[model samples]
Target: MSQPRTMKSTAKKTTAKKASTAKKTSTGKKTSTAKRTSTAKKTSTAKRTSTAKKATAKRTTASKRAAKQTMASTTGTRATRTQATRAAAVEGAAAVPLPDFLASAGTLTLGQRKLLVDQALLILDQNYVHLPLKAAMHAVNPLQRLRVMRARMERQTAETMEPEWMFHRQMSSIFHSVRDLHTNYLLPVPFAGKIAFLPFMIEKCYDGAGEEHYLITRTVTGYSAPQFGPGAEVTHWNGTPIARAVALNGAQFAGSNDAANLARGLESLTLRPLVIQSPPDEDWVNLTYIGLDGSTQELREQWKVTTNLPPMTDLDAVSETSASMGLDLDSDEKARAKKALYVRDVVELEDGQSSAELKTPAAVGGADLPTTMPGVFRAREAVTPSGTFGHLRIFTFSVQDPVAFRDEFVRLAGLLPQRGLIVDVRDNGGGHIYASEFTLQTLTPRYISPEPVQFISTSLNLRICRRHKDNPAGIDLGPWFDSLDLATETGAAYSAAKPITPEDGANDIGQTYHGPVVLITDARVYSATDIFAAGFADHEIGTILGVDDNTGAGGANVWTHGLLAALLNEPPPPDSTSPYEALPNGANMRVSIRRTLRVGQLSGTPVEDLGIRPHETHKMTQADLLEGNVDLLAKAGSLLAAMPHRSLGVTTSFSGTTLTVTLNVEGIDRVDLYLDNRPISSEDLTGAPLSIDILEVTPGQSLRADGYKAGALVASRRRTV
Candidate 1:
């Protein structure tokens, strides 16, 4: 089994994102990352000093796990773990009273509560780019909801005001009503950072008869749900049927559609992102299920809170969240939790030992990849029942360098089996808008048409564009300014839709993987991933296979109050015109300020709420969950088998401004050659290895070739001199 290394999460140039926050914001400038300061940094230090201090006092569940591991390492014995397991069985794995903390901590005074509400309202009303679109699409008006909540709060006395739990829930729900994850009411400190979870995960799989069954697919090591482990079918959750419970739980989340809601709702059962969620109303859940031995089992699982999470410093979290973000709010924490379960606890690398119980199935065992960044890309040859083909799992596009990111992908695709390929972006939540768009051309054989972005026409929106038109470090909203300026007279609802990802960058690395490609996506695929999927479908880049009906549909660029604050208050005295103010008690807020529109034939369509639908859909089967997407791969394989096979490879050799282009082709009747996207020459091939040499082709210019199958274009390849 190949062990794919998970990069230690950080945003530093070295820490990862923040360190190399090259997540080019609107200005296309790489961000200077935030430090994980033991001591406060001067920027927003006074505002965050108390937050840093408050966070230290709590033991997030992961921290507790780490602490126990420290003790076990000191003892260096199996007995310590054995004792810990025993303790877990008697009480619960990392279980504690969550109500006590939520009920006590993060309680804001009435005046502070109203102030927070007002500021959030101001941001949403003034700058939220999706306001008009969301108003038309969803039933709940977020602005109206907030105002209603504020009105209710105004009449309450100190003793009668709703508890902290209700306050957070109400605030979170207003954002949820919009059904856009990018727009969220992040709870204050302790609650904001902690994640609530059960030890084991329950997944829904369809049996042979097409009946749905909930099974315990994974668990924290040593801690099973009582005597039951994987393969146990859960019958009930808190007295309600498990399936129905999932539906109810999912409604509280901000999933864009029913399919997304169900997926998210199911996940909420085991892992809840407290950053965007209130603590589970109940401290513990009574679960009843049928065990593997055909015996019925019942157990009480306590919800555990863990602070062992990814660092979400206000600016860093919000900056990345907005720019590279279509980011599922809880993606960082979810990634950390998943790593703990599958990588940290189960896989032992230092000793070079294997645990067969948890070993990955060979079909899903990623091939040994030699890339510097191993976490983002997973390469494997999937031997599905239909056939064996190259499987490239793009774990994320949320990386620091789009160039390095796409270059590595091109390299990996070249190394894999060239017959057919499965490009899996299942849970990718998106990062770096440019990275996602830049990556599109690598998969298809055409000049990628990037999805365009538009701002809701608002006076504040226009002002923001004007403020940063000259600042190169941040958003240079020059392109949209003229239209926005004209909107006042025209009474336009939105600024002109334009591609944020440059067309040159989008087509820069055109069609690296020429094999008939099938992209696999789930509801978790959002933001940047959404853009990628839309582009894939719009550009006719082979088939799309979905595990759910649609993608997460989070098609907007979000800005945290922090990112907005930085933009408006740059270089010297703060801009008095800026509407942002620090929230009370380290609370934060986010809103999608730019909405994305689909391109190509689906032109002018908003990607939000209406995400890309797949060409084919597969239901999750028992084999899929237990055996590394076996069924899903089979579906992808079958699709790849039927798709047309065509290949085009461009190799360039330049001699003194004269460029020689060599084409290695199959299934192509004729080929067209282009120099820097301009048509230079053409060839009608008859069983020939065609060569096109063009004069006056300068160094550093791009050479491209397109293959035609009987007059219709079929394949393309691009290369730089």
Candidate 2:
């Protein structure tokens, strides 16, 4: 698709009157509160009765003590609210109760339990990818099992069935049965808020022998200190081995990959609250750390509450990379990058001239370089080897209009020192499909045509899906269905576009660039990012580097619903203040509806379970993550420099059933020979491209040759014998 016209530039202005009024209102509230306190003190003094004076003084003293404790806790000082302290201060203040409202699952009526069971079953039936629900339900039909479980729960009293009791019991089991990572239950409570958290951030570390161990990279100040500090080796947690604890935590999110689940669990341990009426006793966490001297030190930890950190929804957010390096969390300016709309506006200069206005996008610590118009996306550029090579760090494929990205690429590609282009999407969470598709299409070479196809398939019947009852995104299926040519068994293939050729103008930014492309990928790539990775890998468009295992397997798009609201007959309004806000006894669930299929075939593998594998493998070490990926970038630069200049020669001859393949190569180091399009021989030609003789050559077999330099597949040719 061609780029669309840019949106008009109308500068936005903030109204200051409202701000001033709000400030006045806030000050008035503070004054009112102070006046009330003063009035109460005066009234107590005015009560001249001796008995009344003693009572007033006693109450005031108790209030002061409570305030002092609160202040100490907030300041991260060791303020122990021991049994003795509770007994001495604020007599009759009730101790926090166990089995809070959230745990009142057992209290639910039979009808409510049945309703929940039926709802869960329906969701699974309509959305889960492995179609023919019965077949997908291998061990035991989830629907039937849930029905039986609900029947059993129906017999229990409110006290026995705690809120989230069923979820705790069956959610992991249901998720584990399916391969969908995105399909899981959201607890029947507010997703965010104060909860129990371990005082330190934990990460998986590997030793020289490839043995796995957990390491503490960061300790929340005022929470965990000294023993659980950064760089400490975590040998155990709460009496459980570190590995075992990770496994147990992973079991809670059954369908997710171990790495993803473990990461999530650890993030929860340190950041997310462990939802309860009051914080779990901090002393419950018994941690044993292995010191540098090989001696083990055991310590009891308290559950700390945080009011600042947000939930860990992204992988990049959870990593304790910075803390381990003794760096502050706010050290990087990029940390402040928030979602924004960058309007392209031009401001007239006082010199009677108009140039594109240069307004820097607000980022945590981002730059504001002078440019023509602003952008919605965040990108950084660097040139090396005296401007012979260019590296563009594309933080995301998310943009207001994907076509704008293509235009940006056009501008970047046209720049000098375009000998190479390194595109980094290491932790991209994904956005619009068009953005990902267009970007990948622009990078791919023309000779590799007839791009691999993609499809979306659901276990539910298409007719039901089209009826729009279960359509969460409210996707318009009519236009989408018409655009695809059916592949096999509900597999829809995208319509083919005219093959891009060299005839396309050189100045065209949409056309493929001459330089080799190096793509950096990691497991965190999800949704559209995963799609781009799959296409890039299948087409052999570039050399992929980084851990390929964490490719998000959360199916495709997600649809969320409030279980409580739906049951109450008062579905939330279009702009409900809190879509996720739980009802008195309600919960929310986000389910995966369609599984994304790339290179679609009825029986072909889906992209959710099988992600793109990189040509070269690399992992982001703790140091790499903390240091802004300096090592990774340097390695990528070296690879770009090593890319061979495209110059090739090859001759194949058949002599008495023997095939002799000779090559003329420059700047290339690896040559691979294929028999009938299947690889037969590969050799490292570091010195020279030497002739090779194939002892056996079938009468009808053909020979194909491919050349690689710096891990990227550079050249290819085919010859019939």
Candidate 3:
């Protein structure tokens, strides 16, 4: 019986292979027979493809889990990804099929064209971040405007416009007109599995004279371009000058700003490899480069095929995974450590065993500074001659529990010895609003409300509650929603008439530090962080420092809705397709329902395309890129040093088995003590550290003690029992 079962399994596997091969052969996807003949190429392709898919899936799963977990606390949404997917899938089946827009888009009747426009307008009215802006941009009657757009697209195509292409063009017109960075229509992935690529990575390079050039960074496996090794300057591609090629490609993408568009162009030059219509025809391109030896060289390079480079979605998935982990796999050491841990866990799973749980071993001497760079969620302290600075780098606001995150943040902030704090939200895309709010309150000083000022509109509260009623996170947001007083419309999204009073501020925390606050930001700082930044700026609570470019203009609350599910008002079948998936390909829209505003700002103001500007601009030089942001930190420290510095005295004493810690905090108002790396006590320092008597010491047990004054570590002492 065992032998027969084994034989059947083998046969099934063989059949799958045969079927896959037959399909490929029928499609004539075999680009290079010579490469297929190579054993190494076959193995490499298989491994790479499998790895890429697994990575993409892992990332997608993690993100889904986070969304579900954070919903209750952040948005009061009880919707699970599974439920949403199923809803989309089920409704998609019954939803009125838009005219096969791709096949006969150009021939679409005026009514059919109007239907698409109407659907889009419906979404814009309900979910656009800034409806007032949208109205201003495209205020004409939906049907009339769509008719005009269709005519324009038809004129542009000069023939029967491709349905998929036309669909994107129509959406692009609306998005471009609105000019919102977060609002754009995506088309389906143009290419899928077994696609052709140039088999090399391109990077922006600068010479001593600061002239910019495109340089080949790395040559991918299974193919070699020795002539185009690293540092080889690409002067032209496929007969077009490098600069012209970049501009042509950049124009294809809609970026939030000039910097983002240029970045996309660089990416396109590297990844958007030439595609051949037929095998053995135009399968290669000529590249003219200034070789390593300073001699100009030209070579005809054949495009390489890789099953790993699946679709745009897969690439984005991998990139998202890498970003979420705060790892640049190509460089960062901590990223490599995390990758190794991931691989180890995978190995454990294959072995039918769970990975070993990490334990916090007893601290020896003092807590050792991590040798590798910290991951995205990290708290580090630096003691400078001027003062101590605590740097908190948070990548995303997504967390399992807002309360838990708040507690951890309080604990971590208490551990740092500092008169200044640097909150770095660089490259952090937004997540849970509640989690960010928690951090904000933890960092902000106590303040009393002056009358009931509206922070959010009643309409937004009602819509959010209705939409997030089934939040799987089981967080009770009723109190929060009920607390808001609905007022007139602000026109951005909601109206604010009364303020949502602060309940958790410095007064709520055990310790409060009146310190200089510096927030590090970049163009990638978006969404919830954008809210945090705007609030901080509006209140004059901190100084915003960024790399010249304003932070990302993503101040809208996003929700994924199936196009059909929303229109039909029915749950759809379970499908894991993302709302950001291209239209016409998938019936979904990544909708922004609620717009975020600064807490204390005037009404109708939103950080849309005009993101929060930095108080001081810092630019990254070539040396900074190579050596890390040491100079930036130094500058931040200098700015922090300008603020007055205060220190407190800490003393420890023991009697019998009781340990008494005294903090002579003069200027500092708060003090905390830790024993053996565990928080023992936190108290207000009123000219004295609230003396704590702990009777936990045992004979022969070594003891270590540390004290913090107003969230900064002030003293450390070790004693033997």
Model 3 residue 270 lDDT score: 41
Best-matching candidate per TM-score: 1
* Poorest stretch of ten by lDDT in candidate 3: 14-23
**Candidate 2 local Cα displacement, residue 44, angstroms:** 65
TM-score of each: 0.82, 0.54, 0.54
Query: How many residue pairs clash in model 2?
Result: 18
* Candidate 1: Cα lDDT at 125: 93
What's model 1's overall lDDT?
0.69
Instruction: Report the C-alpha lDDT of model 1 over 514-607, residue by residue, as the tens digit.
Output: 7889999999888888988998899888899998889988898777787777666764466887777778887888888788998889899889
RMSD of each: 12.8, 23.6, 16.2
Whole-model Cα lDDT of every candidate shown, in order: 0.69, 0.43, 0.43
Best by lDDT: 1
Tell me the TM-score of model 2. 0.54
